[model samples]
Target chain A: MQTKIQELRKERKITQSELADAVNVTRQTIISLENGRYNASLILAHKIAQFFGVTIEDIFIFNEEEENL
Target chain B: MRGLFCGTTARNNEEYRKVVKRRMLTMTILIIVGIATAVTAYMAFHHSTSAISDHTLGIYSGVGFGMAASGLFFLIRDFLLLRNEAKLKQQRLEQTDERLAQIRDLALKPALFTMLFILFTSCLIGSIFYPVLIYILLITVWAFLIVYIIATRYYSRKM
Candidate 1:
């Protein structure tokens, strides 16, 4: 999953720690989600999307692979 | 991993895996402890009860030594593994409050169970193998249940 969290946060001049606090998650979680190391739950993803004034689909793109499994 | 049941925040299986691993370790330790306790009862203190000081002391020593060894084993294992597990958990802590609370409860129940088991054994294992142990076991069960209920009520209220 690719998230627009870093782009949105940077546009708003928000630090990862600040974003994490606002979203009620650890900064490490935010870092991981932004770096594509982890996926966020629906609630967290929704909150991030809302904060960025974007649709969930806009903020996060989930991709299905060919024979990757 | 991505397709795992996603129940809001409960969908995250990493914490579940970690908790299950801890539980498995605890259960394995408990089984070993139980077997050692049984063996210690049958052999160390029973047949030739005179070689040891007192029959009661012999039984107590068996359980005590078993518990001591078990505690030492887990402490050593936990000391080595807890730091790494905790660190990974830190890196992945998007945990919901409910799941976090459940994890805390899971960690505590094992210790509580161990404490109660030891207490019961030390106080009343003499009646073991005989019908007299039935009463002691019943009383211990009731006592533990009542305590657990009271404790749960208090903590629930606090929460």
Candidate 2:
């Protein structure tokens, strides 16, 4: 899973720690999400989306072939 | 390496450096103490004055050597880990993560089930051989369960 978390956070001038605090996750999780090494759980995805004022789909790019068909 | 310390600000990096320093100091102290105890025990065992003293020295040596061996293992582990500050930072990040707690609980389910199975089997076998052992096992299990419940409740509330 690829995420626009780094881009969105940078645009908002937010640090990784601040974003992690907002989403109740560790900075490592945010880093992992940005690096596409780890995918967020549904609840965490929802929280991150809400923090960035976006939909989950907007922040997380899921390849149709890889994720669905 | 990339997880905790990666991309940290200067302030956070300095804080982690202090933490790593403290950890290294503590581990070093433990290793030194363990070695001293082991050496003392070895000397006492070798220079016993009488039979009773020899038996006491033997027990002391066993305990001291066990502590020293475990301490050495931990010291080596800490040395390898702390040599790279980034790895320690990453470890700290993982420890603070809430997802790890949930994963730990999930992992414990299988371990708990296995422990219960073993305890049950042990109790059954003990009943056939020496019924006294069954009572001891029952008490031990009950105590362990109580402690586990208390710890779980405490951590859940605290976290």
Candidate 3:
């Protein structure tokens, strides 16, 4: 899964720490997500989406076709 | 005046540096003391002369062992403190991290399986050579397995 978190966060001029605080996650979690090293849980995904005022689908790009491959 | 001379960041940095320095000093002193005591114990144990009275030899051995024991305690205490401090620091830095939770989940099955495999295999192997020891080990392993299973189930349900 990929996400527009870094792009959106940058556009919003928000620091990773501020985003993490908004989503109730650690800064390391945000770093891992941006680096594509970790996938967020459903609750965390929801929280992140909510914090950005966007739908989860808008933020997270689910690659079902690639997964099938 | 204090705030004018030193901001919050500077004060915090200074306090942190002081704490780290104190910890390093204490650990260094403990290591030196532990080494000295252990060396004294080794010398006393090996260098006793025939001219020394038996009672005096006993007292010397006792004192040496006591010092060595205290030294061992200090070393072990410092080790545990260092490990615990690292863990606490990580926890504080990653207070809401779900990755830590995931890491625990990832580790659980393999650790449990490995422990079970080692205990069961060792018990079976010992049964071939030492029947009495095997029986005791088997009982101990079963007790441990039961406790582990119950605890796992309880935590699974709770979590």
Model 1 chain B is weakest, by summed lDDT over 10 consecutive residues, at B1-10
User: How much lDDT does each candidate structure score?
Assistant: 0.65, 0.73, 0.67
**Which parts of model 1 are misplaced by more than 4 Å?**
A64-69, B1-159
lDDT tens digits, residue span A1-69, model 3: 788999999999999989976775668889889888889999889999999999999998889896686
**Highest DockQ among the candidates is held by which one?**
3
Deviating ranges (above 4 Å) for candidate 2: A1-69, B1-67, B152-159
Please state the CAPRI-style docking class of candidate 2. Answer: acceptable
With a 3 Å backbone cut-off (N, CA, C), the pairs that clash in candidate 1 are: none
| Residue A50, candidate 1: alpha-carbon lDDT | 81
TM per prediction: 0.36, 0.50, 0.51
**In candidate 3, how many Å is residue B44 off?**
26
Better of 1 and 2 by DockQ: 2
**Tens digits of lDDT, candidate 1, B7-87:** 224233465446545644775677577667656655655576454446665666667577657766655654455557554
Winning candidate number (TM-score): 3
Ordered list by TM-score, greatest first: 3, 2, 1
Interface RMSD, in order shown: 6.8, 5.6, 6.7
Q: How accurate is candidate 3 locally (lDDT)?
A: 0.67
Docking level of model 3:
acceptable
> Candidate 1 residues A1-69, lDDT tens each?
788888888888999877875665677677778888777778778888887788999888778672254
